[model samples]
Target chain A: MMDTEHLGTHISKQFNADLENLREEVLAMGGIVEEQITLALDAFTNNDSDIADKVIANEKMVNAKEMKIDEACTKVLAKRQPAAGDLRLIVTILKTITDLERMGDEAEKVARMAKAIANKEMAVANVKLHYGALLHLGNHVKKMLHDALDAFARMDVESAVNVAKLDNQADEEYNAISRQLITYMMEEPRRISEVLDFMWSARALERIGDHANNICEYVVYLVQGEDVRHKSWDEMQRLAKDE
Target chain B: MMDTEHLGTHISKQFNADLENLREEVLAMGGIVEEQITLALDAFTNNDSDIADKVIANEKMVNAKEMKIDEACTKVLAKRQPAAGDLRLIVTILKTITDLERMGDEAEKVARMAKAIANKEMAVANVKLHYGALLHLGNHVKKMLHDALDAFARMDVESAVNVAKLDNQADEEYNAISRQLITYMMEEPRRISEVLDFMWSARALERIGDHANNICEYVVYLVQGEDVRHKSWDEMQRLAKDE
Candidate 1:
């Protein structure tokens, strides 16, 4: 197994604190991103423009937090000049926050889709917009993101790989929703615009799942010093579990 | 202006060469990604599965190149212990590859869409899946990506900002195409699937523009040491030229 304790055993206590602080900041940012996804989904399912607006408003804070974490990472790299695991930790944080920021952007897109759909009522009175699958998919990805963040906080490579493996499930769920939406459009062509908007929101949720998987991969890399991206899931699971 | 010469004046000749080699790798990777977009678009416009297969095959190489550049950056950081401009260079390259790799994925999506559309021909007789706007948008983003890489190569903040401004134009083009496609779908409901596929290709092209803009933003950060993300184009231009 990797020497996980070495991450916190630097001769410079301040450097250790810097790394710890960076981790905390990332978890905090992840919390905001997770909340954004939840709210964006609630807005879509419940047709609540107020919740969507809140998500949009919170996006700026998310962006600011990303910039803050990035600057902190640069400061740590320049000042401490850490090597080995510490260096990997910083690199992983840099990459993780980029994914987090993109997750926030995806959440914003979901919110925008919600707003657009709310502003324009569905053309057909009886043809209700089906969102059961989207809600299920949203919850699945949200749980995956939460678990991925937990793995990051604990530096657990096995759990990280497991979360990464959830991506296939998310893709399947997304494909099912796409097929269902395509059927709806065919049945009632007048609702095509709104149905397309729903597809975009579902697409956004699927992308959030992707970003969460990326974070899990980065976690595995940070802990094990192995790059698991673009690898088959079987290979990733084997590598993560080998040691 | 920031001291551009500092990037090349490192005392260790090997360190300088390593940084130079890293830049070359990134540009080479960018070239491959650019070609992927061009080929993917050709595949879509011409309904040629052969070119689509070529783009799909090229994606593996793109992924491999990203991993190689990432490893090189990590090595440079661990060994050279670069700071300031050199550190930013490595960070910028890391971020650039991520965007470039994503651009490659978007290209692959376009190729997949082309294959899907070609396999199951459009349901309508005379609907004619339009390509005029999509071709224009594809070329616009391609040039934007090219200019963004040129800005990175020269570390020119001004050029980066100018290229970043083109994102608005790309967005406008995408919006126009989306509207036109919606009209076609409404006119011929049977062709909705094919029109939607066309919409996806256009969306993919628009995303490529966004990634190119992201790369330009990273160039500004690398050269000027300013995090200009989430800022207005006016602010980015002012910041890029202020010195």
Candidate 2:
């Protein structure tokens, strides 16, 4: 039984309001997760072990938040047995928390890489890349995450679609950077270890971007009651147009 | 309104039976996905374009099966509105199908890699070593999937735990293969493209193994009704002991 004293609302209204709180909770968790990614990438690019430590420490916070949200969802289901649209939305939330948590996991991987390379600076400084593409991709991904959350908040299908479209550019950047890193490794085998860490970070960021896109797709499905997840990008684009 | 005459069972009994049907459907889907992985890995290791084409073709079947299972889960939720243990089991089924579908996607990635490198084998053959560890890992992962699915069927926590334990060795094999491939790339710059494809397939296999471990953990959670997913392996081992 939910307490009705917050607004002195009816039980039915309170259940409705609790669902709203769940959304707010998810968004708050998303905010912390977004910051974790920034802190991680900053730590990674600068080789700052202190920032990396912060990211690692904050991981527990993200995990705890996910558990709290999941419990809230299960409580709602067991108590209310929400039907149809509400059920779909709650299930979508359930799915997205894992993605958000996974994004944190990916960021933690980058942070761990940062921590590992913190004391090994000279090795990394020796490897030359083309035009700072990894940095560019990392920066673009953080913004993509920001917008994906915003789109989710408003259930903005168009905005989510646009963010998903940026994935192609991110893919191109990942490929270009990977090729340059390979060339670097080929030329200076001594720098292989250092370059490999950077490659993993790039791959992690790219996956984070993919997960962000996945969250937005879930939002579209939540709003439209259509499972757009199983389709291709072209099909998603068509679906977005109808929205 | 579920059809009660399917088995001529009472409504309550029919709901119970439908849950069984959901499990069987998931297992049936899991079987095909397992076959897809075996076929894809066989294609990758042999560089058989014909077999790779078969794996790629089989992907649609996997996707369709996931959709069908998803629909079934939704039907159960709407009709039965199962609570407690039954609800948790249905939810677990929902989560694992996404994982299984993603496993199929990873296999498709390996298949595509096989297709890309099928005609261009000279570079790959030029740079190889280390007792076929990658092949061994792929084969073991298929076995891990077999046991994990078996654990799900019987609610056998011990079997699930064993499969999860095997992930550490799989991780080691994947890393060793990756390092060897990197060494190959350094030795022969012309082989970078081919080696990169092999590396992607190895990473995909590693990820597939990870998803397998995740499914096992879900089995543990299903039986114990505890969320042990966010814990470390040591933490999980400790938690399991407490259980």
- DockQ winner: 1
Q: Residues A151-204, candidate 1: write the lDDT tens digits.
A: 999999888888877889999999988888887777777778788888999999
**Which 10 successive residues of model 1 chain A have the least lDDT summed?**
A1-10
lDDT of 1 at A210: 96
**Model 1 error, position B64 (Å):** 0.8
Clashes of each: 0, 0
Worst lDDT run of 10 residues, candidate 1 chain B, spans: B1-10
Pairs of residues at least 3 apart in sequence or in different chains that clash in candidate 2? none
- Docking class for model 1 is medium
RMSD of 2: 3.5
Tens digits of per-residue lDDT for model 2, B1-243: 333324345777989889999999989988998999888878866779999999999999988998788878877877766778888898889888878888899989988987887867564555445327767888888888888899899998778788878998899989889888777777776566677778888899898899899898889889888887877777667656776
TM-score of each: 0.93, 0.93
